[model samples]
Target: MISSVLPTYNRAPLAFVKGAGSWLETADGTRYLDLGAGIAVNALGHAAPVLVEALTEQAHKVWHVSNLYQIPEQQKLADALVEKTFADTVFFTNSGTEACELAVKMARKYWYEKGAPERVEIITFRGAFHGRSSAAIAAAGSEKMVKGFGPVLPGFVHVDWLDLEAVKAAVSEKTCAIMLEPVQGEGGIRPAPDAFLTALKQISDETGTLLIFDEVQCGMGRTGRLFAHEWSGVTPDIMMVAKGIGGGFPLGAVLATEAAAAGMTAGTHGSTYGGNPLGCAVGAKVMEIVAEPEFLAAVNAKGGFLRQRLEGLVAAHPEIFEEVRGVGLMLGLKCRLAPGELVAAGYAERLLTVAAADNVLRILPALTITEEEMAEAVSRLDAAATALETHLA
Candidate 1:
């Protein structure tokens, strides 16, 4: 039999019928612990009552309207984002790729409007995963992402990650912006050190280059902070956010300071369903929950517990895992075996995990996962490691 849908993803041979709070049920009634959490989209966990209520209520009233009109839901979400982060303005998009597109455009337009039309080049780092759009692929500059695509986009300048000297050399007057991920997600959960971030900020300030942070995967509550850059106390001129902001709904946003967004006037950029009412409603509720001080504190505590347990696992099975790295709930285990092999083993153990580059396994549990769920997740991982060892032996 042929499949109807486009085979874009190498999907697992499993179909989940329902999910609730750290667990997913397959069509055949088999339950699995859901540590992936829809690739970190379900920050409040699956089928959270607060998110469900918000979505249901908004769906009953209004689902979408044109951007020409004043959508109260959109305004409320924008207001919440502005209040929480360093941004003074917000532009909603349907996904992180769109937000990345806007961020690039906004940076170029800022320089253009300031009478420096030649300053259109955006300096991006290697191993950074911005998104999948044309601009994003170019910004990422990865051969795996840009190989089959036609001629790559022209305005992006790629450099090695953490190479401060290279970044300094790259930032000529033609450079419009310096874009990077505070914590590189698809690049194998590598975090830019706090000192390195501060250095980048200082260099950007000295050179008047706009700094953009693609926080799509590490933002929200994934890092036990509102945004990962907050941990370094180094803010970007513009930031991209998504994945968890809608609590499993599809929504993304580009946030900018006032001066950074000065070039975005009427008719500059717009989306038909960017800030749709339903998405904004759910996003507002997500903000309310994640922005709570107690909730953030709990995430930090849970992250500590999970990291400690994972360290123990690595020590117990040195042949399986090399080390554990990453911050907060967004953790990664560097494996001695191929990450895909461990992923298959995890499926057999009825535990879901995500794979990343450099033979790393990503453990992105929901922010609201309970202590018991964390323990179970570790135990399942232990079993998977044991199984792999036995098979290899």
Candidate 2:
């Protein structure tokens, strides 16, 4: 017997009736300290006042006018993105998957407009999770992602992670661009080495191949910077951003340099609900608060403090945790056992976490988490570890 809704996701039994700050409460009042932050979407935390105000205010004024007309809120978000990023132009979407689709189109179109239509292939790296879209799965080139979805989209070449020589050899006359995540969220919060990014940028410059960064999970102040790539001192020619950008609202964008976006003229791409007043208003508010230098510095400070605490946790529970990986608030704890074991243990302790590939548990708390909250979260994690050890013994 199938349920009313699709059973695609193996959802947790618990359901939250309300959320405040970093805490979510069930209907029966069981509260959980949320470290996943709705899978890193709620940057400012659950039910943030600023985002709420922005959403409701715009809801009262206007909602969807579509891309056929000029939208002030959309223009404001675009301007903010352009000012804060290397992108000269922006195209809004409803989710990161949509952004991936646009990024693929923009990359291939760039070559087509440059009279190099044959240069359609894009070089991607292993352990990269772009999205569930056909193009994104093809770019990942993973059997788990592309299996059963027969006849996968073509023109993507995969290589080993951080193998500069592999990337160098993979690039040919047919290569259009190289795409990767600065910090892979689903692939286990893997942060690329800064040196590797620098080398990739050099390769792009030499080969005229565009560098595309999927910052959907690591951008919008999650990495203690505006974006994760900033830490590498290398900017992407085309960037995909989402998640925290809208402070829990459905919003994503494809940011591109003028040269890269030249091919996407009028009618080349668009969306009906993208850049709607409601989403853009919330996104603008989120950007206003997150783009502050002081806010980002605080994130770095908290990230360091949290990492220090996590290192102690890993030391205390060598039987459970392997090591800690990642940067800023986007941290992951490699588990000695399957990460799902820790995830289920966290649930028993009323702690929320997300499990990923490579046997890692993602800890993506709100950027605005207080020091006291961090302590509590860690305490709960310790309790969960103890419980796991006892249950196993």
Candidate 3:
């Protein structure tokens, strides 16, 4: 362990030296079937030829230019995103946390512009993972994360997910918006009910509050669609996107309807590295590959297959896995054992999976993973479960 670096993350014992497609190779040449995909960032899988070629091609021509100048790549990516989604305007950031910060700022500023300066309270759900920024931490209201982090930011409220009555009761004259993850990723991979999302939209419309969807972990084809909200037929006033947007590179964005972004007229928000040429070029390439109709269809089919296999595993080992949850390739296995123990067992079996909130095992394979890789992941999972069951029994 590197003692110099902060011991913030509870990292696994092994270290991956390289990756290709759905596998990670350690220094000792041991290959592990990677289902987490760098926490769902590698949408195209590792070392995709197209992404490599595009990134390499752009590397020689130019890398970055200040956001002060015109960037054609940024415009192209933004135009493509706007064309496919309900967004009429867009802002770029370098990570999901920044995108989330922008979304929160935009929501409050929008209401302030409408002469409702008191409408600054933003309603967020109880198990939603927005990001790690101060504002995001405050919005999420996770006592575990917010503890000992000085005073929490003000004007944010938390409510029970999918409980319409609690949400209605929480909203007051000061409420400016409601934010949620369309498919909650860190919170045990629980997907918000379709009726609940639709109801939130209805309530937002009735109360004149903005609706923001944090699709950072679940968006960009992770859930077999450009955005998970599409599955529910609900369009958010402001949407935050990251993770798969840049493939393996770092990029995030906040897209919004025209009215919701009116307050962000020049100088309201800016980032030095946001929308630079290098990130934009790579992001454009990623968008080109993932935005295809056939690619999205394959993601859906693959996700269905993965879910079916996971359900079968649950049935076979009811003592280990309680339920399978989530949408598309972002599947989760509710476990009877401690999630960390399962992850450790998986590591010992040379399989890598992510642990999530609520003691669920997160299986977020690449959208481009093949059938054989899916089977291999399940096999390893079964082995790990059996090993743990023997120890526990």
- Report the alpha-carbon TM-score of model 2 versus the true structure: 0.99
Off by over 4 Å in 3: none
Please count the clashing residue pairs in each candidate, in the order shown: 0, 0, 0
lDDT of 3 by residue, 1-393 (tens): 668869988777788888899988989999988889999999999888888888888889878887888988899999999999999988989999999899989999998899989999999988888889999899889888799996999989898877899889988999999999988999999999899999999999999989999999999998888899999899999999999999999999999999999999889999999997888888999999898989999999999998999999999999999999988898999998788888999988888889999999999998999998898889999999999889988
Residue 264 in candidate 3, Cα distance off native in Å: 0.3
TM-score of each candidate structure, all chains considered together: 0.99, 0.99, 0.98
What's the lDDT of the predicted structure labeled candidate 3?
0.91
Residue clash pairs of candidate 1: none
Of the pair 2 and 3, which is ahead by TM-score? 2
lDDT per residue for candidate 1 within 215-281, as digits (tens), equals 9999998999989999999999999999999899999999999999999999999999999999999
Ranking by TM-score, best first?
Answer: 2, 1, 3
On residues 1-393, what C-alpha lDDT tens digit does candidate 2 reach at each position?
A: 999999989999999999989999999999999999999999999999988888989999999888889999999999999999999999999999999999999999999999999999999989999999999999999899999998999899999988999999999999999999998889989999999999999999999999999999999999999999999899999999999998999999999999999999999988999998899999999999999999999999999999999999999999999999999999999999998988898998999999999999999999999999999999999999999999889
Between candidates 1 and 3, the TM-score winner: 1
Q: Please tell me which model should have the higher lDDT, number 1 or number 3.
A: 1
